[model samples]
Target: MMLENKVVAITGAGRGVGREIALLCARHGASVVVNDPGVGGGGEGGDAGPAQQTVDDIITAGGKALANLASVADPVGAQSIVEDAVQHFGRIDAVVNNAGILRDAIWHKLSLEDWRAVIDVHLNGAFNVSKAATPYFREQNSGSFVHFTSTSGLIGNIGQANYSAAKLGIVGLSQSIALDMARAGVRSNCIAPFAWSRMTASIPAETPEQQARVERLKTMSADKIAPLAVYLASDASQGVTNQIFGVRKNEIVLFDKPRPVRSMTKTTGWTPEAIADELIPAFRPSFARADEVSADVFPYDPI
Candidate 1:
């Protein structure tokens, strides 16, 4: 009962990781608000069945829960999700920004429409929900924000320029919120989850390697990511803000925020030639490989 008497709002709770988190949070004593417009993988079309089903599951389990069919991409809709939680439950304790859509494309071929579509739902959507919850969090003097990021952004990926940009932007958003709200007893953190879901299913699997990767991913269930998210949403994670975590099946990883790994300071700012000779050589060994993608960074099977 880590979350007894608490209320949590979770976006994208219709299925997959979001659904798992919502259900687990309710089980741990938090009144849950399950929000999902039930859009397809590419953000096209919508339905209410997914969100309602999650709510039904929670209620059937004897937990307090409610369903909210709203697109997090819409500022007004996003606000309603938070407002609904407060109106129904009397207070809000945590917000999980998990709604997302994929429109993967290589950088050269990526269109403006796809770029905006991805950004609107992922980066802007996260901001919209978090912003709507800020006042309540500030007044209550306690709240948590658990944002979903991805290795496609944290590490690297192929043909996901828009997705990568939005995901990385969310990391920055999470960090900034953590720093800005620390004094108000608010916490913000990110999770780079590795799971097989509708999002992953959209990845092109035409090649042998790509198909193999998908098969490997199928072994990792969406539920495997819920425990850490539930912990972050509860009082148990006090003093655990401003962190980025990776959840791959049974393994959990903490990531170091970007910092100077190798430094070579030129007292008198060097010319281009001098930098080429000295700084480049000094930093070469520490430089990450330009070709490495998410799979390369995590070559082993999920543990």
Candidate 2:
């Protein structure tokens, strides 16, 4: 019972990674608040069925759960989720900001509506949920936050400019939250999980070769990622804040925080010409090659 008696609220718990996290948390003895607006995969339309179904499943497995239908992007709605947890379960020990939607388009072809939609759901949604829940965590003097990020943001992707921006924002946001709450015993960490969730399933793979690749990728199940989220939510990973972790099939990756790979300082301000001559050549060897992406880093399944 790693999370015994703990109350945890997970957004987007209706399906995919969020669904798995809720189930795993409950199996580990946590009372879960499954929050899902039941929106369509693109964040349109809604239903209560998904959240309710998850709750029913959890209870049937001998666990406590509450169904909450609140869009984490709405401040008042997000606040209601925190309040719902406190009122129903007595206290909330963890908040997992797993709510998200996908609106993928190439940078040149991306629309403003699509951009805002993704940002609001992923970035603002996380902020709203975390902001509403932070005061309680501060007062309780203990809590954990697990924010969902993606390798698309960590590295780069062909399309998904909005998603990449929003996910990277989560990384920075988690770091700041971790530092700000360290003295209060609140830990925040980000995870870039490579699993076959609804988001990945949406990718069009029409060619036979692409279809076969997608089939092999089915091995990377959402359930495989739940254990990491469970550990991060439990006391086992205490004092491990502000770190970014990646889970890909049987492999786990620890990404290095941004640091200068090579540095050259000019004590006196350098002219543009001097910079072109010195800086360009000095850093050329260390420069990242063009078009490196997440898939390239871990293309094959783990041995």
Give lDDT tens digits, candidate 2, residues 1-303.
Answer: 899999999999999989999999999999999999999989999999999999999999999999999999899999989999999999989999999999899899999999999999899999999999999999989999999999889998778999999999999999999999999999999989877878888766888856865776678888888898999999898889999999887778898898868878899988999889999998898888688877677667663
TM-scores of the candidates in the order shown: 0.98, 0.96
lDDT of 2 at 201: 87
Where does candidate 1 clash, by residue pair?
A: none
User: How many angstroms is residue 176 displaced in model 2 relative to the true structure, after the best TM-score fit?
Assistant: 0.3
Candidate 2 residue 276 C-alpha distance from true site, Å: 1.8
lDDT of each: 0.94, 0.91
Across residues 205-230, which tens digit of lDDT does each residue of candidate 1 receive?
99998898889899999999999999
